[model samples]
Target: MDFGVAAEDEAFRVEARGWLGEHVGAVTERRAWERALGAGGWIGLGWGEGGYGNRTASLTQQVVWAEEYARAGAPPRCGHIGEKLLAPTLVAHGTAEQKARFLPPIAAGDELWCQGYSEPGAGSDLAGVRTRAVREGASYRITGQKIWTSLAHEADWCFVLARSEAGTRRHQGLSFLLVPMDQPGRIEVRPIRQMTGTSDFNEVFFDGAYARVEHVVGGEGNGWRVAMSLLGFERGVSTLAQQTGFAQELARVVRTARETGAVRDPVVRDGLVRLWAELRVMRWNALRTLGSTGDAGAPSVAKLLWGGWHQRLGELAVRVRGAAGGVGPVAWSASAPYEMDADQHLFLFSRADTIYGGSDEVQRTIIAERVLGLPLEPKGDMG
Candidate 1:
C-alpha cells in the first residue's frame, strides 16, 4: 500500500488537526466534549456505507480523523460504544423506525450506550450467554448480569444479548435488545476496580428491566448474526486511532529510557527499537485490512498482533523504569488512596490487553480454524 496520503485526504488531515488542536484542549468534560464533537461533525464518520444519511468520509479519511484525534491528545472517548459500534449495526440490521429514532441522538451526542454482552460465565464464549428476556405485551423484561461492561455507569442505554425464547441453547433463540438504564430498581451498576486503581469497567445487573419490542435489532433469534457483525465493525477506522495512541505510548517509553540512561543498556535499547519498528508494522497491517471485510480472520489477526504487542510494550514501560516502577505516584487521591504513575498504570492495565475483547487464545483459534482451514478445537466442559 502506498503510504502517501492523497491530496484530498491531506486536506482533510489538515482540517481535522486544526479543529482538534483548537477544541480538544478546551473541552475537559466528557459529555460536553462529546457534544462539541457532534456539533463539529466529528462523530459518525462512516454511516454512509450502510446508506445512513450523514457526511461520510472515505476509509482513508476516517483513518486521517482517527490519527489526528489521537495525535491531538484528546481524552478517551466516553461515547465510542454508541458512535462506532452500535450505530453501524443499527444501520445494517435495524428497522427504519429504529434507525431514524436511534441514529440521530447518537450523532447528536444526546445519548450514550454500553454493551451488555460479556457475562461472568460467558465472557470469551459469548454464545454461552445466560441473560434472558421475557416478552410481555409491548415490551421485553431482561433479567441477568453482565460483567466487565465498560461505561455502564454513564450510559443512558444498553444493547443486550439475551435468551428470548425457551429451549434455546448456545447461540440460538437470542435477541439483541436495546434497554434504557434509567429504571431505578430494575437495574444496578457496580464498578470493577482494575489493578490500575480505576473503575471504568462495571458489573451491570438487570432485574426485570423493560425494553420496547421495537427496540430489538435483527429480529428475535437472529442476535448471533447481528452481534458478529458488530464485532466486524471493531476493525474499522478506529484501529488507526488505536495505533496512533500506541505510538504516543511508545514515544513516552522511549523518552523515559533516554532520560534515565536506560538506553545505554543493550537489552533496553534493543527492546525500544523493536517496539518502534513493530508499531509501524501494525499500522501497515491495519491499513491493509481496513476494508477487507471478506476476510473472516482479518480482525482476529489484527487483534492477536496488537494485543500481545501492547502487553509487551507495557512490560517495557516498567522495565525501563527499573525498581522505581513499583512505587505508585499520587496522581488521583479522590478516586483511590494512591495512584499509579504513567508507567505503573500502563504496566498494570495492559496486563488485561490480551485478555479482554478477544483473548489471545481465542484470536489464534479464529485464525487457525477460519484462515488456515485447521480443524476446530474440541469443545470441553467449563467446569
Candidate 2:
C-alpha cells in the first residue's frame, strides 16, 4: 500500500480542509456544512460512477478527504450510516430501483440510516437473530425486538435482518429488509442510557413493521451473506477518520497528564509513549487495509485491533488523571445524579469497546475458524 499522498490529493485535501474549517460547528452550521458537501459533490467519494458525487475519486483522494475532515473537527456526520455502510451495500447488492430511490437522498444528506442487525440474543452471533418478517402480498410484516441499536430513535430507515422462512436455523432462511422507522404504533424505540449519560443506544421493537418486498437486498435466504458484506464496510475508509479522533483523545490524555503532574511518574510516561506508538501502528494498519476487497476475516482483524486499542486509551485517560480519576462528578446528589467529565466519559464508554460491533471473543473466533482454518468451537445442546 502506498503511504505517499499525491500532489492532487493534497490539493483536494486543502480544499476540503478549508471548507470544513469555515463551517463545521453548531447544529445549523453543521447542517449547512453537510449541504455544502453535497453541493460541492464530496459526499459519495469512491462509491463509483452514476455521479451522485462519486464519479472518479481515487482511493488516495478518499483517504485524504477523510483525514482532512477529521482533522478539521467537523461535526459528527449525520448521514454517515447511509453514506458509508448502507449505500455501498445497496450499490453492490441492491436492485437498481432501490439504488435510485435511496442513493440520491443519502448523497444529498436528506436522510439518515441506522443498522438493525443486533438483537437481544444475537449481538455477536448475528446468525442467531430471531426477528421474523413474514411476507404478505407486496410487503413483509416484521416482528421482533432489536437491542443495542445505535441511533434507532433518529434514523429514517433501518436495514434489518429477519427470519423470513420459518423452521430454519443458524445462518439459513433469513432476509435483509430495509424497513422505515416512521410507522406509528408499529415500531418503538426505547433509549438505553450509557454511563456517559448519553442515550445514543436504543432498544427497538418492531411489531408488524412493514418493508416493501422490493426493498429486500441480496434476495431471500441470503441475509447472512449480505449482512457480513455490510460488516466489511464497517471497517472501511472511515476508520482513517476514526484514527484522527483517537489522536485528539490521546492528545487530551497527554495534556491532562502534563497538567496534573502525572507525567512526572515514570510509569505514566512509559504508558503515554506506548499509547502514542500503538496509535501510529493502528493508523498505518488502517491505511494498509483500505484497498481490500471485503475479505471475510479482515473486518474482525480491524475490530480486534482498534477495539482493544481504544479500550486501552480509555484506561490511559483515567490513569493519567491520578487519584482524581476515581472520583465522580462534583456536587454529587441522589436526585440529580453524577455527571461524568470528559475523561470519565471516555473511560466508561470505552469499557464496551471490546463488547460492541462484534466482541473480542467473537472476533477471535472469526480469525481462528475462518482466517486460520481452525475448528469451530464446540456447541452444547441443553436438550
Candidate 3:
C-alpha cells in the first residue's frame, strides 16, 4: 500500500484539518456540533446529493477527513449511526421513498439514530432477536426491549430488528423497522452507566411504538441480511480515526511512563515498543482491506486485530501507572461512582473492547465458518 498521500488527498487533508482546528471546540453540544458539521457539508461524505444534504467524496478523501478529524481532537460524532450505518443501508436496500425520506435528515444531521440489534437474550446471537413488530394497518406496532443500545437517550430514531411473524424461530420472520422515539408513554430509554462513569449505552423499551410500514428495509423477513450488511459497513473509513485516537492514548501512556521514570525500565520500554509496532501493523492491515467489499471476513478480521490490541493497551496503561491506576475515588454510601483519570478509564472501559461490537469468539467463528469454509459449529437440539 502507498504510504504517501496523493496531492488531491493532501489538499483535502489540509482543508479538513484547518476547518476542524477552527471549529472543534465551538459547539460542545453534539446536536449542535452535528448541525455545524452538516453546514460545512461534513456529514455523509460518501453518499449522493439527491438526499439534498449529503456530500460525495472519493474514498481517499474520506480517509483524509477521518485522519484530520482525529488529529484535531474533534468531538466524537453523535450522528454516526445515522450517517454511516443507516444511510448506506438505505441507499443499498431501502425503497426510493425511504431513501428520499430518511437520507436527507441524516445528511443534514437533523436526525439521530440508534441501533436496536442486541437484546438481553440476543447479543452476538442476533438471529435470536425476540422483539416483536406486529403490523397494524400501514404501520407496525413494535413491542420489545433492546439492550446495549448506544446513544439511545439522544437519538430521534432507532432501527430495530424484530420478529414480525409469530410461530417463527431463529432468523426467520424477522423485520427491520425504523421507529421514532418521541412517542410519549410508548417508549422509554434508561441509560446504562458504565465503569467509565458514562452512560452512552442504554436499555430501551418499545411498548407498541409505531413504525411506518414503508420503513422496512430490504423488504420484510430479510432483516438478517440487511443487519449483516450494516455490520460490514462497520469497517469503514472511521477506522483511521480510531487508530489515531489509539495513538494519542498510547502517547499519553508513554508520557506518564516518562514522567515517573518507568520508561527507563527495559521491560516497560520493550512493551511500549511492541505496542507501537503492532499499531503500525494494524494500520497497514486496515489500509490493505479498504474497499474490500467482497471479503466475507474483512470486518471480523479487523475487529479481531484491534480488540485484543486495545485491551492490551489498557492493561499496559494501568501497569505503566503502577498502583495509582488501580485507585479510584471514595464511595461514601450515597456518593457518585468513581471518576477515573485518562489511563484508569481507558484501562476499565477497554475491557469491553474485546466483548462488545462482536466478541472475540464470535469474530473467530465468523472467520472460521465464512472465510475458512469450515463446518458449521454443532448446535444441540433445542427440542
What C-alpha lDDT do the candidate models reach, one value each? 0.88, 0.83, 0.86
Per-model tally of clashing residue pairs: 0, 0, 0
Error of 3 at 223 (Å): 1.0
Candidate 3 worst ten-residue window by lDDT: 324-333
C-alpha positional error of residue 162 in candidate 1 after TM-score superposition, expressed in Å: 0.3
Residue-level lDDT for 101 in candidate 3? 89
What RMSD does model 3 have? 2.2
Candidate 3 or 2, higher lDDT = 3
Q: Which residue runs does candidate 3 get wrong by more than 4 Å?
A: 48-53, 323-337, 380-383
lDDT string, candidate 3, 1-383, tens digits = 58667887777787888889889898899899998999898998987555545567888898888888888889898899998899888878888899888888887889999999999988878888889999999999999999999999999999999999888888788888899999989999999988677898999999989999988998989988898888877778888789999999999989988987778889888989999999999899888888877888888888998899898888887777773444332221345446567777788888899999989999999999999999998753221
- What would the TM-scores of all predictions be? 0.95, 0.93, 0.95
Name the better of 1 and 2 by TM-score.
1
lDDT (C-alpha) at residue 360 in model 1 = 91
Point out the higher-scoring one by lDDT: 1 or 3: 1
Which prediction has the highest lDDT against the true structure?
1
Clashing pairs in 2: none
